[model samples]
Structure formats: C-alpha cells, structure tokens
Target: MSRIHSTHDDESIGSDSFLDVVSNIVGILIILVMVAGSRAKSYVREPGEAKSNIATAMDAEAAKADLRATRRTAQSLAGELDMLTREASTLANEVKAAEYARIQLGTFVATTEHELKKQRDELDDKTKRQHDLAARMVAARRKLDDLQREQISVVSTAAPEIVVKSYPSPISATVFTTEVHYRLLNKRLARVPFEELKDLLLDERRQLVWKLEDLPEVSGSVGPRDGFRLDYHFVRTVRGGSLTAAYYIPVESNLGEPFAEALAEGSQFRRAIERLDRQNTTITVWTYPDSFDEFRQLRKELYRLGFSVAGRPLDKDSRIGFSPGGSKSAAQ
Candidate 1:
C-alpha cells in the first residue's frame, strides 16, 4: 500500500511539467506572427512617401515659370510709362512757347494801330488847310479877272460910256408918257439869268440885226408887238489878233399898256399903282443891295419906255412882307 501511493504521486508530477512546456511553445509562436505583420506595413508606407516627394518637386518647377512671366510683364510696363512721361513734358513746353508768341503779336498790333490813328489825324488837318488855300486862290483869280476887264475897258477906243444917276428926284412932265413895272422877291432884287438873256437874243435873230446897219429904222413892230423891241448894231473889230464882236443894244418901245395888263393882281407894284392917281404920279422902286446889277439893266428899259424911274435902297438882309412890331405886311 505504500508503494502504490508513491507511484501515483510521481505520475501526477510528470503530467504537470508537460503542460507547462506546451504553454511556453504557443506564446513563442504568437510573438513571431505579430513581428512579421509590422514589417509588411512598413514596406507599403515607403512607396507612398516616394510618390508624395515627386509631386512636390513638379509643383516647385511650375511656380518658377509663372514668376519669370510676371517679371517680364512688369519690365515692359515700366518702359511704356517712361515714354509717355517724356511726351507729356514736351507738350507742356510747346504750350508755353505759343503763349509767349501770342503776347508779342498783341503788342505789335497795338503799336501799329496807334501809328495809323496819328496818320489819319494829320491827313484831316492837311485837307482842311488845302481847302482854305484853294478858296483864297479862287478869290485872287476873280480879282485879277476884274482888273483885266477894267484895263480892257480903259484901253478901248469905241466902248460905251458908264452912266451913273441918282434916284427919288422929281419926275419930269414928259417922263410919264410911258411906264413899266417890275418886281423884287423877299426884299432882294433878283437878276435875270444870263441863260434867259441868251435865249432872248437867239429868239430875236441877232444875226439879222447885223445886216440892218444901213437901214434908217431897223426896229418897229416888224412882227409881233411883244413887251420889248430890240435895235442892235453888231460891230466887228480885231483885238489881240482875233476878230471879236461888239454889240450895242437900244430898246425903243412904249410897253405901258401891255405891261399894266400883264401885271398880276396880287403883285406889290400893281397894288401900289392901283392906290395912286394916274396923272402925274411918280413911281418909286425900293431896291436891295443884291439888286445892283439888275437895277442897272432895268433902268435902260424904263428909259426906253419913256418913263422916269426912281429907286430907294434897302439892305440885303431886310425881310419882305414884314412891318414894325412883328406885324405882317399884308395884314397891315
């Protein structure tokens, strides 16, 4: 019984030792499998890291190309800006020069205008002086012509005599055998125009009078008995190596009846004569200073008509149809 108990205890001890050994072997196998799995994961991570590094290098190259293009554009823009700045400076200088030229032209025009005005004033003064000198020269020429006429008259051998007479004297008994009337306008004795005298000479056929020198009575109501009768003798004379005509006119007629009828009703002379008696009434004419030449011509006609005429002289400035105290002559 002792032997059997000891053997059983030995068998139990052997079995426990064998179980410990098997557990140790299984732990070692598990450690080996974990180490292999960790190594394989490390290999896969190495390939991905290499691909990421290549992509980074390509991106750096692209960024370099873009920077170069940006730099070139900036340089070109700077050059264009410099050229525009220079053109702006040149235009500014040209504008300043044009302004200076305009100022100079304005100054020159002002000076020219002043000179032209001065010349115009001088011309007007000269023209006025010239006109005054011309007027003086004309007056001198007229005086010289009068002197020549006087000299010619003094040297003439067959010239008519100059007769001077006074007026407003008593009329002779035989003077009122015939009478005539005439007029003065605005208190001025207006002369007969030379053209009217020339027309009268032409109408009377003065050439026929030249042939009638041998006849005793060359004029007496030959044709129409008008207001006048002309008896003229034309004399030929050689003066200054030229043949000249010298004529003498004599008016011989009684123009009383016709002249009285021809006088207008409203005339001053007609009105005056109507208030006077017909017999032995003396007629007096008021003469103006301007009528000296006309009076001389009219005196001959009155003398031919067998009428004695008297004159009272008045000033040239005297007003006609005016009385004292500002009254009208007709109203008075």
Candidate 2:
C-alpha cells in the first residue's frame, strides 16, 4: 500500500507543478500586452509634437516679414507728415503778410479821404470869395452909372418944347415950323435916364434949317419922345418992316469941361457980354467956394457984373434980365 500511495502522490505533484507553470505564463502574457499598448501611445504622441514644432517655426518667419513691411509704411507716413507741416507753416506766413498789407492799405485810404475833404473845403471857400468879388464889382459899376446920369440930367428925357398955336389964318399955323431935330435917351430902372445920352443925334432928313419946307413930318408918337418938323413959305405981307422975335432958354455948365479950361471959358464969356457981341442969349457960370457964405458972395458978384440969374435969390432988389423987351423988362 505504501508503494502504491507513493506513485499516486508523485503523479499529483507533477500535475500541480504543471498548473503553476501555466499560471505564470498567463501573468507574463498580460504584462506584455499592457507594455505594447503603452509603447504605441508614445509613438503617436512623438509624431504630434514634431509636427507642432515645424508649424511654430513657419509662423515665426511670417511674423518677421510682416514687422518689416509695417516699419517701411511708418517711415513713409512720418515723411509725409513733415512735408504737410512745412506747407502749413508757409501758408501761415502768407496769411500774416496779407493781414499786415490790408491794415496799411486801410490806413492809406482813410488818410487820402481826409486830405480830399480838406481840399474841397478850401476850393469851396475860394469859389465863394470870387462870387462875392464879382457881385461887388457889378454894384460899383451901377453906382458909377448913376453918378454919370446925375451929372447930365438935363440932356436926357428932356421935355419937348412943341408950340401949339394959330396964326392970323389958323390954317397956316397947322404947318411945321422947325427943321433940324435930334433926340438922345436911354432906359433906366428907377429914375428917368435923363443923363444916359452921350451926344445929340440928328435925323437923316433934317440936317439943315434951310430944308424946312422939304423936311418930312413925323406923325407917329412914342413914349417920352421929343421930335419936330418944319415948313417954309414965301408970301406977301402988309407990314412994311419985319420984326425979329425968338424965344430960348440958355443954360451954361462946366460939368463936362476940364477944370483948367472952365475958368478960361468963363472969362471969355464975360468979355463977350461986356461988348454986346453977336450972341442974343447968354448965361454966366459962377464959381464959388463950397460954403454958405460963398452962395451970398456969388449972388453979390453976379449983380455987380450985370448978371442976375440964380437958383435962389439971397437978397432983395435982385433981378434977372432975360429979354430986351417983354414982361421981364416991365417987372424989373
């Protein structure tokens, strides 16, 4: 029995050792599989890391190129900005110059206007002075004319001495009596221009008294006119002797004569009257001092010299002898 049991136990021990060997093989196979899975995972991770590194290098190159381009553009922009600044400064200088010129021009214009105004005022004053001087000259001329008229008052606007009468036969008196006639006159604003005439002018048809019968008779009338005509006839009369009678007014004046000649003319007149010369009408001009006593002296001298006409009588018994025979002789 012991031998049989030993052989059986040997068999069992072989079997147990075989089983233990199988278990150890299975554990080794599990460990190898896990190691293989971990190796494969590491291989995949290494490939991803190499690819990532390559992509990062390419990105760095592109960034460097972009930075260079940005720097170039910045330099160009900075240069353009400097040019703009220079132009702006130049324009500012021009504006300042223009403003200064405008100020000077305004000042000149204002000063010129002021000078023109002053000149105008002076011109106006001169013109006014000239006008006033002209007016004064005109007034002075008018005054001189008036004085001249007063000196020759009797020569102009003289009343006519026309005789209206009838002869023995009234029809004969209708004929004209005088031949030579003249008129001198002028227009006046205030008083009659009695002194405006300078010289006596005769009509064309009546130059000589002998032309009486042939003289034309003036019939028309005008204002303030003195005119005359004449007629002559040769007829028989009953009277054996002829009588001469004439009427006239004689006035003498030294108004227009020079002072030196006036005295000589007065002396000649006195001599002629003393000798009873051929003149029928006579008047003496008396010169006296400009005083009241001179008027009396002139009257006394006139009476002493047989001349008796005065503007007014200053003494009694004074008389004027105009005609040799007439009412004048009777009154004296």
Candidate 3:
C-alpha cells in the first residue's frame, strides 16, 4: 500500500509539471498576439492621418482664394459707387446753372418792355399837344376872316356911290410873255409856282408817253412843290391827225400864308415878288369869291409896283387849270 501510494504521488507530480508548461506556452502566445495587433493598428492610423492632412490643406487653399476674390469684388463695387456719386453731383450743378440763366433772361425782357411803354406814352403826349395848337390856329384864322367880311359889307352898304379912279398906264393886252401867278383864297395870299410845276409836268410827260400806246388817255400827278400839286390829264387823239396834248390843273390845300403875314417884310410872298423881274413878268391873280376884296388890294399893289395885273375870277370849287384851247390872260 505504501508503494502504490508513492506511485500515485509521482504520477500526480508529473501531471502537475505538464500542466505548468502548457500554461507558460499559452501566456507567451497571448502577449505576442497583442503586440502584433498594436503594430497593425498604428500602421492603419498613419495612412488615415496622411489622407486627412492632404484634404485639409486643399480646403484651406480654396478658402483663401475665395476670400481674395470676395475682396476684389467689394473693391470694384466701391469704385463704381464713387463714380456714380460724382456724376449725380455734376448733373445737379448743371441744373442749378440753367435755372439761374432762365431767371436772368426773364428779368431782361421785362425791363425792355417797360422802356418801350414809357417811350410810347411820351410820343402820344407830344402828338396831342401839337394837335391842340393846330386847332387853335385854325379858330383864330376863321374869326379874323369873319371880321374882315363884316367890315367890307358894312362899307358897301353905307356908301353905294361908285367912285371912279383913273391911272395913266399902258393899254390892256394879251399876256404872251413870262407870267408870275398869285393865289388869293381865305383872305390869304401866296405865290403859285406855276412855271416850276409846268416844268415838272413836262419832265413826267416824257416818262408817261410810252403809256399812251396802250390807252387813248393817261392821267398823272406832279409834285407838291411849295405846297401845291399839279394833277394832269394827257390825251392822245388820232382824229384827222395824231395829236398829243396835256391839261394840267393846280390843286391847292393849306398852301398860303395869312394876308397879314404875307404882306409883312421878309414874308414868303414878298421874297418871291422881290426875286421876280417886274418888267418881264406879268402878275396874274387867281381870285376866289371869298377873297375878292383881298385880290383887289393885291392887284392895286402890284399895279403900283409897275407890274401889269391880270385878274382871273374863279368859283369857290374851281381849280386853276391850263388847256391848249384856253384863253390867254389880258393884262393891264
């Protein structure tokens, strides 16, 4: 029993030693497995980190490029805004200048209108004054004429006896020489520029001769020389023979000085008479009914001055005229 028990103990010690060897082998195998796993994990992590770094660097570069582009865009927008602001300011200044010019032009036009109105008013006032003076002169002349008429009527009614007077002078004869004409009307006396008007009519006849070809007669007017105008009628007749003739008439208006003023020294009538040669010029008086007394006085004065006088009695409405068939003046 002791021997069997000792054998069992020895088998058990052998089994125990085998078990310890198996445990040591298993622990070494586990340690080696853990080290290999750690090395493999480190290798995989290194590759993943490299990839992440590369992606991050690319993203940062893109971001910086976008920032630079954004800055450039902002700067461009700012420059455009500044340019627009300057243009707007320039337009505003131009508008202000145009408005000022319009205001100035309006003011100048108003001033010119005011000056024109003032000048018109002054001209109107002067015209009114001149008309008033002319009216007064006409009134005074009418009154004087009436007074003279009254005086002559009274003298004629008071003495109806005829007084005969004789003067030594040459016998009456037809006037065929140079003649000086005088007009007596409205108690006024004036020289008739008959010769000058006739000469002017002759000059106009030269120009009017061509008109006779189209018409049998032509009428024309000459000057207003010395306040008298000559209206003439020219006739062209082919009866029996071709004949051209002109009939001229003197038209008178406010053409004479008042008798009192005309008889004064250095008067227009006096100066005209002084310039005439009495020896060669026969004085012809055209007398109107209203101025018969004045004409008689003028005739006596002309006779006293050694000038032969011829009297032509004309009605109030008659115009002094000359014709080819008219009678010559008989002067004494």
Candidate 4:
C-alpha cells in the first residue's frame, strides 16, 4: 500500500510543473504585441515630417529669384538718373552765355549814344562861330566901299573941266511923239493906260510945271539925262477916313502881260512899239529897287526894237508924283 501511495504523489508534482510552463508562454506573447504598436506610431510621424521639409526647400529657392530681379531694376534706374544730370548741366551753361551777351549789347548802345551827343554839340559851336565871322566880314566890306566913294569925289573935284564934260545933258522929249508909261509896285510891273494918264494930265486944278537943272541923283530920278525931261502928277486924298494916303494904281495895259506867256506866243513889248512910228517912240520904266534885274531885261528888249528906254528907280516907300520941276516926283 505504501509503495502505491508514493507513486501517486510523484505524478501530481510532474503535472504542476507542466502548468507553470504554459503560463510563462502566454506572458511572452503579450509583450510582443505592445512592441508592435509602438513601431506603427513611429512610422506615421516620420512620413509627415518628410513632406514639411520638402515645402520649406521650394520656398527658399523662389525668394532667391525675387531678390536678383530687384537688383537689376535698381541698376537701370541709376543709369537714367546720370543721363538727366548731364542734360541739366548743359542747359545751365547756355543760360549763362545768353545773359553775358545781353549785358554787352546794352553797354555798347549806351556808349554810342554818348558819342553822338558829343559830336552834335561840337557841330553847333562851329556853326555859331561861322555865322559871327560872316557878319564881321560884311561890315568891313561896307566901310571899305564908303572910303572908296569919298576918294572918288575928291578926285573928280580936282578936274573941273573933265567933270563938266562928263555931266549929263538936258534930254529933250520933243523928238519923241509917242510916249508910254510903266509902274512897278512890290515886285510886279504894269503899264499905265494912255487914257488914264490923259485924264490926270488934263486936270487943270492939278496942273504943275517947273523947269530946273542939275537935280540930285535920287530914287525914281531920270538919271544922267541930257536931252529929255520927265513930267508926272497925281491927286492925293485920304482913304477910309484914315490918315493913310489913297493911291490910285491905274489899270494895267495888256502890254504888261507875263513875259513868259508873251515869249511863248512870239510876241513881246514889240506889239506896242509897232503902233507908233519907230523914230518917234519912247519907253519909260518906273522901277522899284526889287525890279532892277527885270528892268535890265526890258531895256535890252527895247534897244533891239530900235527904241530909247528911260529908267526911274523908286525906293520901298516912294509914291509916283511930279517934282515942282519938269521931272518925275516921288513921295513917302
């Protein structure tokens, strides 16, 4: 019996050992499962990190390209600014040159005007001096002429016989049957009508006649006459109830027409001479001082027509009348 009970206890111990081995195998399987879960979580996180890194690299390359483009634009703007600065400098120089030229022109004009004024002043002074010299020369010549005239009178008195022979003879008018009268007033010459002269001469109240010799040489005198005598008379009256003397200027005859017009028609004072006998005709010219040159021309014309010419010169204020003697009279 004892031997059999001991065999049973040994078999029970062998079963307990087999049970412990099985429990150890199950704990080892649980540890392997926990390790596998940790590995899976690590793999998911690693893939996400790799994608973020790739995006960062692309953004860096794009920023570098933008920086290069901005630098190129800045360089272009600097070159344009240099060109504008050069143009501004050239414009400033041109303005300065124009200002200098304007100043020079103004100075030159002022100097020229001053010189012209000086020249004008000098010319005026010279003209005044010349006028003074001319006046002095005229006065000296007049004095010299007076001295010569006085010397001539002394020489003439030394030779009485020669002076007597040189004396003019008394002119006789009996030889001339036809006599014409002329008057000069101002510078105009006119012939006195024959009818008007006859009216004045026939007036008995104004009749005056005198005979004289050696009359003074005066204005309107029949100078140096030896063969003929002159007769003149006129009435005197007040004009407009004033003290001024009334002068009756006779109507001019057609013979006293313009010489130019007469010459153009080939007719002159010859027409009046043809109406009378050539040997008995005489011409008397009453001349003013201003008409001396014109009287010379008339004298030459009368001589060509074979007629004698007598001249009676008058002063500026003389009037036509007869002297108490049988000669032309003049009154102021």
How much lDDT does each candidate structure score?
0.46, 0.39, 0.72, 0.51
Comparing candidate 1 with candidate 4, which one achieves the higher TM-score?
Answer: 4
Tens digit per residue, CA lDDT, model 4, 63-109: 44544444454445445445545654564465456546555665777
Q: Which order, best to worst by lDDT? A: 3, 4, 1, 2
Put down candidate 3 lDDT per residue, 1-332, tens digits, no spaces.
Answer: 34444655565566566556555655654565555456455544555575876445554555556555555655665565556556545654654565565556657777888899999999999999999999999999999999999999898886777998664355888998889888888888877778898899877877766777677888768887777778877776553112233333445566789987887789888888888788888989888899998877777777777788988999998877786777888898
TM-score leader: 3
Q: Cα lDDT for residue 80, model 4?
A: 48
Q: Which model scores highest in lDDT?
A: 3
Better of 1 and 3 by lDDT: 3
Clashes of each: 0, 0, 0, 9
TM-score of each: 0.29, 0.32, 0.48, 0.32
Error of 2 at 132 (Å): 1.7
Listed per candidate, the RMSD to the true structure in angstroms reads: 39.2, 38.4, 34.5, 37.2
Candidate 2: which pairs clash?
Answer: none
Cα distance off (Å), candidate 3, residue 107: 98
lDDT of candidate 2 at residue 47, scale 0 to 100: 46
